[model samples]
Target: MSGLGDLVARLLGRSRAPVVVEDPPPTAEQIADAVRDVEARIEGRVPAAVTARVHRITGTVEDMVPRLDRFGVGDRQAYTVVATATSYLPEAVEGYLRLPRDFADRRVVSRGKTSLMLLCDQLDLLAVTLEKISDAVYRADAQALVAHGQFLADTFGQSSLDHPGPGAP
Candidate 1:
C-alpha cells in the first residue's frame, strides 16, 4: 500500500509540475497584438452576448498594462505581479465553447453549465479586480483595495453552498 501511494504521488506531482521556461516579458507592441487577436477570435466564435462580456473584461485587462505603472507596479516585483494578473480567459472561453453538448446524461449537462457559469463569473470578478486596482493606484489609497476585497469576499460567500442544483444549471 505504501509503495502504491508513493508511486501515485510521484506521478501526480510530476504531471502537475510543468517545466519552467523563462520567456521575455511582453512588450507594448506584443501585448497590443495579443489583445487584438483575442478580440478577433471572440468575435468570430462566441455569441454576441458572450463576445460583449469577453470584450468588457479583456478591455480592462489591456488598460491595466499601461496603468500598472500609474498604480505603483513599477518596482522589481512588477514583472511577477503583471504576469500573474494577466488574463487566461481566451483559453477558458475557447475550451467552454468546444465542450460538447451532452443532453443524454442529465448530470453532465448540469455539471457542464455549472462550470461555464463559474467561468463567466470569474471573468466578471477579474474585471472588477482590475478596476479596483486602478482606482486604488489613482487615489494612492490602500483602503479602496480593502473595500473591494471585502466586496469580493462577500460576493463569493461560501461558493460551494450555492452550487447550481440540477435544474438550476
Candidate 2:
C-alpha cells in the first residue's frame, strides 16, 4: 500500500503490521558472483593458502554454473555450491579475519594447528568438494558424447579394419 493509504488506515484505527517481503534465493550466477566477491574481499587479507583455495573454489563454482541444470533445483550438490559461496566460505574467512593475525597464524588452537592451518584445511576441503561437483556436472556431457559415438558406430557398422588383431601389421 501507498504511504497515504497506510496513514489513512492508521487514522481510521485500521492499522496493520507492515508486511515483510522476503527476497527469493539468489540464482546460480548470483551465487558464483558472491564467491568471486568473497575472493576479492579476502585477497591479501588472509594467508596465501586461503587465497589460493578461494580462487580454486570460485573457479570450480563458475565452471559448474553452466551445467547446473544437470543437478535440477534443490539437489544437494546445487545446495552445497550455493551454501559454500554464501555461507561456508565467507564464514570461514571472516572468522579467521576477525582474529589477530599473529595468534591466528602462529599459536596452535587445536590439534596442534593454528587458526590459519585450520582455515586452510577447511578451504582445501571446500576446494576438493567443489572440484568433485564440477566433475560430476560435466560427466553428463561426457556420457552423452560416449553414447552418441556408440550410436554412430553401431548404425554405420564397425569394420574389421577399425580394430585389427594385436599381431596384425
Task: List lDDT for all candidates, in order.
Answer: 0.59, 0.86
TM-score of 2: 0.75
Error of 2 at 113 (Å): 1.0
TM-score winner: 2
Model 2, span 2-109: residue lDDT tens: 888988987888877575798787788788788888988897788777888888888887887767667776799988888888899989888999999999999999
Candidate 1, position 116, lDDT = 50
Off by over 4 Å in 1: 1-21, 70-87, 101-115, 141-169
Scored against the true structure, residue 129 in model 1 reaches a CA lDDT of 62
Tens digits of per-residue lDDT for model 1, 115-148: 4565566666655665666565556557778888
Report backbone clashes per prediction.
0, 0
